[model samples]
Target: MNPNPVVAIAGATGAVGVEMIRCLEERNFPVKELKLLASARSAGKTMKFRGKDIVVEELTEASFKGVDIAFFSAGGGISRKFAQAVKEAGAVMIDNSSAYRMDPNVPLVIPEINPEAALHHNGIIANPNCSTIIAITPLWPIHKVNRVKRLVAATYQAASGAGAAAMEELEQATRAFLSGEPFEQKIIPHPYPFNVFSHNSNVDPETGYNEEELKMVKETKKIFGDDNIRVTATCVRVPVLRAHSEALDFECENPITPKEVRDILAKAPGVKIVDDVSANYFPMPKDASGKDDILVGRIRQDISDPSGRSIAMFVAGDQLLKGAALNAVQIGELLVR
Candidate 1:
């Protein structure tokens, strides 16, 4: 790898794509040159990086020719179509979509949880699902110390996970509803403003689990390298615009207390403890938005479990930042390290 690598952003105009640019700037990743690639329609647009205007180009077979690292936040379709081109160009593709995450050869990595997995990437590295990243980042520390036998996560995802248009639609729909006007939805399946629904991803009729939920289950196992570690998730789309929140219950092998769990997470990288029982304060989407760290709090022993081995906690993280863009950038940083 070059001491200062040439970086490319595949979906430079989209939500996560824009955040990727910001992360590179914020993290001060060494870059010899920057290329911004988007759809043809988004071509000719210019995005700024390191105080210079870089024109967005149409993504093509030749886009990755000189890019040392290609950060792909475009949809899976684009990644599927161009990933090989990226690899053929000899650029390390850090993808932030579901395209190659489950591929046997590809490594699904969250730097905090599985940085070593990235060392084995065969040209492409997959970033886990946004909800999965937010949920699992905090789990890794505890699971590293005390074995986690099972995981139960219920995510209250935000509109940002869908894309920037969905976030705008939510705002538009909210204003229309406030004025007593009928609102039409575009990005999401159901009504957006002041409403919540199951995740919009296709559901498996047999298991009654949505694609988002299934990703959490499968990706967790793959990242943890523990096929036997039981995992289940119920993912829902909430009215929030940015960060995603999850309630996780961990079933461990031995008894653990709330203080022990809290102490573990307090020192864990990429985590922020927000539990303030005196003021009833805890992790909130408003506080987590635009932040790099995943906020974890509301730690307590599971009241329903008599074995004293179960712990419950609430976590919030910016799905676009730490969940997608920052995580991919972190992987890119690791690649050059």
Candidate 2:
């Protein structure tokens, strides 16, 4: 990799793609050149990077030429279509889609957790699912200390996970609801004004788990490199516009205390402690939006477990940043180093 690499952002005009641009600039990533690639519909549009407007180009197989590092925020289909081209062009692709996450050859990486896994990538490194990243970021510290045995998570996902269009639909639906005007939701499956629904991903008939929930379970084990860890999740799509919140309950291999958990997280990279019981304030989506650190609070020992090995906590993180763009950028930073 070049000391200053030419970075290409696939799907540059989308929500996560836009945040990728911001992260690269805010973090002062050593970018030699920036190429913005999107569908033909978004081509010719200009997006700002380092006080300059870079024109968006139609993505093609030829787009990876001269690109040393490619950040892909496009959907799985697009990532799959151009992956070989990126490999052939000799660019390292840090993909933000689920397309290659589970592939044995590709590494699913969260820089804070398992950065060393990224160095062995064949050509593409996959960013974990948004909900998976949020739940696991704080857990990695705890798992390292106590060896998590089981983890159950309920995610409060925002519209941003769906896409930029879904976020716009959420805002529009809220306005229509307030005005008592009939509105049709086009992006999301359910009404987004002030409603919550099960994640829209298709559910498995045998297991009754949606695609999002399955990703959490499988990705957790894969990223942690511990298939023995038990995991389950119920993913919900809330009306929030950005950031994702999660309620996590986990049991460690040995007895663990809340204070011990707090101590571990205090030193964990990419985590912020927000556990203040008296003031009744904990991690909230409003406070977490736009922040790179995952806010964690509500730390307590689970009363249900008499054995004293279980703990509970609540966490929030910007779905588009740490969950997607910033994570990909962090991986890029690792490669450049």
Candidate 3:
């Protein structure tokens, strides 16, 4: 890798893409130049990085030439079409889309959990799903110590997971609802104001699990290298505009306590403890938005399990930062090191 690599941000106008640019600047990653690429409609716009304005260009087959690292967040279709071109251009493509995550050749990574995996990437490394990153950042430390036997997770996902337009739609819908006017649903399938629904992803009729839920299950096992972990998840979309929260219940091979679990997470990387019982404070989306660390709290023993081997907890993290852009940038940093 070049000491100061040239970086490109695909989908530079979208929510995660914008954050990808911010993260690179915030982290002070050594960059000789920055390229912004988006769709034709988004092209010609300008975004600032390192105090300089860079014009966005329409992504084309020639875009990746001479780029040392490319961060992709456009969507799966764009990734599928352009990933090989990125590799052929002699750049490492750290994809933030679901396009290549499950590919056997690609390393689906959360830097805190699988930094070693990034080293083995065959030119393209995949960033895991946003909800999966929020859930597993804390879980991996515990699983390493206790050997998680089974994990059941329920996610409270935000509109940010869908995109910037969905967030705007949520805000618009709320105002319309309060004014006693019907809001037309556009970005999200159902009514958004003060309503919660199962994840809007296409569902599998055989197992009754949405794509997001299954991504959590499969990606967790793959990242941990333990297919026997027995992971299950339920993903729901909430009215929140930014961060995502998840409730996780894990049955470990050895008995564990809430205090012990808390202790483990405090020492873990990319985690911040926010548990305070007396004041009734824990991880919340409002607090987690714009933060780099995943805020974790609400640690307790799973009461249903008399065996004392089960622990439950809650976590909140910025879906756009740590969940998507930051993680991808972290992978790029790994390549540089």
Candidate 4:
């Protein structure tokens, strides 16, 4: 194997940033040197990596100087401002923001399905939206054999996708609601504690779907290499802290039965079939939290379209793992290799 490259992390103190560090250590990615970069406000913070205290440095255009790979979990504005600079400095960028996702030149990647596309990157590789990532990992294997024709999905997302502040907001709001306070809500437009609502992004007038839903439909189709698949999604913000769960109803070109779907997904990489409804053993947010694999459960025949080609299932995955940081790091691994 080629020698490990010097890796740098932008937004080193954020939620996904912390998980990125853990994932790097967990997967034992070749790392000759590790650099942690964050905002000027977080410059003096100290974070442990591989048993060593790694000091956080303020991210600058010059931060990519000796770095060969940079994983960016910063917001879109920071990514738009600095990603190209990092790339120009000779480091490949794996960005975890929506900034470059829709760019025709930038590949929105899911390694399980499209690792090959990472090689064609000019500078940055885009990580798909969190909800989309969790959904597609399990959906792709079935799509490969049966070919999904259309889907109607409803997402139950955790607070982590909105970042650390949002997680904190949910917590604080929950406490406030329990204590009979006004139940202040800001990170999410609706009351988050014990309540679920549509995604906060602006709604599309025609489809009435939020931006997150649109991303799921568009990104899923792109990552699966199928433009003909029609997907309509309703992304919801729920009280869960980590895993994102989706109730998916799929119409496939090839006929599909529950047993075949189970068998196909059971052998699929990056997926775990947890569908035993009689035992209440299907995927749950709490059980799926902190794990990398997407869990599928509650499998059944869709009554509306019981043609054997149409089916419904539920899936849950760690939004921060397979959805964001891990996927970005996997892209980096693919690029470096």
RMSD of every candidate to native, in Å, equals: 0.7, 0.5, 0.7, 1.4
**Candidate 2 lDDT, 258-336, residue by residue in tens:** 9999999999999999999999999999999999999999999999999999999999999999999999999999999
> For model 4, how does the per-residue alpha-carbon lDDT over 1-337 read when each residue is reduced to its tens digit?
2258899999989999999999999999889998999999999899999999999999999999978888999998999999778878888888999899989898989999999888888888899999998888988888888898999999999999889989999999999989998866777788899999888888999988889999998998778878899999988889989889999999999788888889989898889999776788889889888898999988887778756789899999999999998898888789767
Q: Rank by lDDT, descending?
A: 2, 3, 1, 4
Q: Scored by Cα lDDT, where does model 4 land?
A: 0.89
Q: Best candidate, lDDT-wise?
A: 2
- Tell me the TM-score of each prediction against the true structure: 0.99, 0.99, 0.99, 0.97
Tell me the lDDT of model 1 at 78: 96
Global lDDT of each model? 0.93, 0.96, 0.94, 0.89
Q: Candidate 2: lDDT of 283?
A: 100
The runs of at least 3 residues in candidate 3 whose Cα sits more than 4 Å from the true structure, single-residue gaps closed, are none
lDDT of 4 at 207: 82
Q: Judged by lDDT relative to the true structure, which candidate is superior, 1 or 2?
A: 2
Better of 3 and 4 by TM-score: 3
Lowest summed lDDT over 10 consecutive residues: which window, candidate 4?
A: 1-10
